[model samples]
Target: MTRDEIFKGLNEVFQDVFDDSTLEVEEETTANDVDGWDSFAHITLIVSVEKKFGVKFSMGQVSSMKNVGTMASILLEKLA
Candidate 1:
């Protein structure tokens, strides 16, 4: 899938996980950009994304991600 498609789906996951429908995610979005995005929430977000996209992320992939863009890039690679 394309990055835009990934972002579209990923945004839905973030909105659902955060319980904020108004949340708009972009490439540079980070945990600090959203409230309640702590370590635990990060894990939840990761799992939710994995399930939503039917993809599993390794520990390194999860930990190395610096922003939504990087995650989307990784997702694109995995989906390819």
Candidate 2:
């Protein structure tokens, strides 16, 4: 899938996880950039993302993801 498609899916996951339909995330977005995005929410987001995209992320992959951009890149690689 294209980056636009990835971002579109990510947007939906983020919005659902955060319960804010208006939420929008950029390449640089991180947990600190959003309210209520603690460790718990991060796990939920990861699982939700995997489910949305039909891909799995390793613990290393999860820990290494610095921001939304990194997550998208990883997804791109997995999907590829």
Q: Taking the tens digit of each residue's C-alpha lDDT, what string does model 2 give over 29-51?
A: 99999999999999999999999
lDDT of each: 0.95, 0.97
Q: In TM-score terms, which candidate is top?
A: 2
What is the overall TM-score of model 1 with all chains considered together?
A: 0.97
Q: Candidate 1: which stretches are off by over 4 Å?
A: none
Instruction: Please state every model's RMSD to the true fold in angstroms.
Output: 0.5, 0.4
Q: Which ten residues in a row have the lowest lDDT in candidate 2?
A: 50-59
Q: Would you list the clashing residue pairs of candidate 2?
A: none
Model 1 scores a C-alpha lDDT of: 0.95
> In model 2, which runs have C-alpha deviations exceeding 4 angstroms?
none
